[model samples]
Target: MIHVAQITLETKGPRLLFLRKEDPVRFTWYEDLVQEEKETEVFSTTALEAIRLAYLYWKNYSFKTLNCGFRYTLPERDEHGNNALFHQMIASYSSMNGIYFDEDLGHNCFVNFASDEAKNLWKNLQSQKRL
Candidate 1:
């Protein structure tokens, strides 16, 4: 089954830490690891809680709005063979909003605001595909 693996956001400093559905002790361990690896303070509790909430909602529901004016919608079906529908939906919305989606990272996907460069890349990529 599809799962919400991670949520990444662009910030002024280092990326915020958001744990998934791990126990408190494990989560703390992950936080410590991030601190050691990144050498940056990661806000785990609040950010992780937020990501958990968003993930739960997305798992049960279809769509959600991010802090920015961006909205994320999950695909309806879980068929492994076809991602065309999902890609098409993302492409249409991304084009309209000037946003671009990154390659799927495990269970979660990443999207960023489409600047001129991103738009051109997305357009070029889309032109060669059916969906």
Candidate 2:
């Protein structure tokens, strides 16, 4: 049986906190998701502008940005052997939901779990025994 971890988010003011639970009291937290309320609020204004420009490159394009939290693994020497396998399992399941790996960003190695569509997709795929 494949066991996948869960992603939880806590929004405090404009900063978003990401968490992953393991043991009862052990929770790993890292990274922050800041709401881009204004153009200046974005960390990389230039990058954001570039993305917006590229997004508009396609005609009649409708971009839907969803808040799908991310799941992170510990930085360990044997991460590839242990964590990678587990992460892959989670990511595979996440892909069934609308969540995906943000390869364009530095978060390429991490799994992003967000989107109810992805959750439904994963459920359907599981029912079909394709996953």
Candidate 3:
């Protein structure tokens, strides 16, 4: 019963709560908090699995760019001097995975895990700098 939500301006319905568009996506794992908010989409089994799926989505987008004449060695920069390829990959990944994304406002990927294992997994990923 893990719940996941993306902070976005758009709401799926009246029940969905919207966070500020600029808020960064965060991983939260607490039963009481989730219990308080009953409208969140209850999907996903664990935070680790959700994160791994996101990574795979990113990897899938990277492969698509490589095939589209984007360089793997030297990535092209966007107008903001950010890596264009990386942004593109992130956009694709976020959209495909039901995370919120805005070209101007930016994307924030948020997740809520229902189990203690998910909390440990998040801490482990953070310690390893893999998140």
TM-score list, all predictions? 0.19, 0.26, 0.18
Model number with the top lDDT: 2
The prediction achieving the highest TM-score against the true structure is 2
Model 2 Cα lDDT, one tens digit per residue, 8-97: 324332222223233444333222333221111112124334334433532233322223334453332123322222224356445655
What ranges in model 1 sit over 4 Å off? 1-112
Model 2 CA lDDT for position 48: 32
The local distance difference test score of each candidate is: 0.33, 0.35, 0.30
Better of 1 and 2 by lDDT: 2
**Deviation of model 2 at 92, angstroms:** 6.7
Candidate 2 wrong stretches, greater than 4 Å: 1-54, 57-59, 65-67, 76-113, 125-131
lDDT tens digits, residue span 1-119, model 3: 22222221233321212111112344322212322533223223444344344335334233111111121211222223222222233333335553434344344432222234334
For candidate 3, the per-residue lDDT at 19 reads: 16
Lowest summed lDDT window (length 10), candidate 2 = 36-45
Sort by lDDT, top down from the best: 2, 1, 3
